[model samples]
Target: MTERQILLVKNSWSYVIVKSEEAGQLFYHRLFEIAPELKSLFKSEPKGQSRKLINMVTLMVSKLQKLDEIQGEIKSLATRHHKYGVDPAYYRIVGAAFLWTLQQGLKDKWNEELEEAWVDMYAVISNAMIKNQQAVAA
Candidate 1:
């Protein structure tokens, strides 16, 4: 993607940054709706897990444009996620929930380009996460 496209994606995500709480809520709600089984990974209560879920997303969104700068942190996060039983497939589910939440939350503001941006961002983030897990396993 061109720098303009990158900027577009970053700008679109900027809107999400302002509404981080709502965005995280939407993401976790959609995630649990799709994968109720994963709920067992969280504690008996959902509040703490929910906070963690949202906080992670919020951090990811805040750093989306600076992937290289935060690679180490992302790797650490991926490792922690693994300890919680998160696998690559769980990344897919999280991505789906993330995109769905953005689309539903943003409504008309979302378009093909924005969708592509989000997809690309998720790919980069998830790949780094998976790679980190693989490295640890190796």
Candidate 2:
């Protein structure tokens, strides 16, 4: 990612993280709305799962610049997710729901640049996850 995009992601995330719990709940709600079938994949209670989601994504975003350090973690997450029965195609739906949740949280601050930066980041993360899933399958 470009420095500008990295900056955009960091800056925009600050706004959302302030209400991390709410944002996390919103994301799950949106995710379920988009793909109701996915609801069964989650084993944790809603609030707990919401907190976990925020925590994991927070760790992932915080280490974005040093992704080399987290590649193993990310791939392992993918492998665990694969075992949980997450379809690879569901990543795109998750991305959409995530962006929508961001838009809802960021409100006036959300824009093309921010959206693009997130799309770029999500693409990288999800592609890695999907690739790792494939590797694990093989």
Candidate 3:
């Protein structure tokens, strides 16, 4: 991603981060709406799960420019995700829900540039997480 794109995501994220709780709630609500079958994969309470989601996203967004630095962590997260029932195909749906949630939160601040920037960032992160996984260990 270009430095301009990275700045766009970070700058827009700053506006919405203040209401992260609501953002997390919206994300899960929208996610379940789109992929109800995936809801069963979650083992924690909704509130706690939301906190975990937001916290991880916050960490990732902060490190967007140096995603390689967090590659190990991202891959480990992928392993946990596999154990939690996330399939390789599900990243697309997750990205959709994530982008939609960001739009809902950012409102007027949401634009094509920010959306594209986020798409780029998510692609990089998801690729890192998925590149090493062939199958979930039994």
Candidate 4:
């Protein structure tokens, strides 16, 4: 998938539209199911963490259409995540959970096109975050 196709998915309401109180809980549940050990890192109430996740993701997606404008914000987020000890593998976990949520959220509408769009989009965003993290390390 091209970057444009990826952006089409990112700018969609797929993330924010389906974003609900229950969605967060479901995300955590699915996340733990895939990566049980990561559960220990979230030392807060599930609801609180889920809210944070929802808000953070919403903000990120909202800014995706203007990535150049949000470069600093993205860098800051990546830096903070680094301090939190979030590595590439952890990103994979979150991405997987996110995709699962969309799949469940969109149901029949969730086609291979959407899946590829999300995968490509994740690669773009994750690489940007990694680059930002590396820049900070340098």
Candidate number of the best lDDT: 2
lDDT of each prediction vs. the true structure?
Answer: 0.76, 0.92, 0.86, 0.77
Instruction: Give stretches of model 2 more than 4 Å off.
Output: none
TM-score of each: 0.84, 0.97, 0.94, 0.82
RMSD, candidate 1, Å? 2.3
lDDT of 4 by residue, 1-138 (tens): 466774667655464466567788888899999999888777889989988877776776666666687778779888987777777668887889988977887677778887887777777778889888877767
> In model 2, how large is the Cα lDDT of residue 15?
88
- Specify the highest-TM-score model's number: 2
Candidate ranking (TM-score, best to worst): 2, 3, 1, 4
List ranges where model 4 is wrong by over 4 Å: 1-19
Model 2 C-alpha lDDT per residue in residues 54-100, reported as the tens digit of each score = 88788778888988889989888989998998889999999999999
Give a tens-digit lDDT track for model 1, residues 1-138. Answer: 446566766677678767766776677678889998877776645556656765665577666657677878888987887888777788888788888988987888999988987788778778889999878766
- The segments of candidate 1 whose C-alpha lies over 4 angstroms from its true place after superposition are 44-65
- Return the clash pairs for model 3, or none: none
In the predicted model 4, the residue pairs found to clash are none
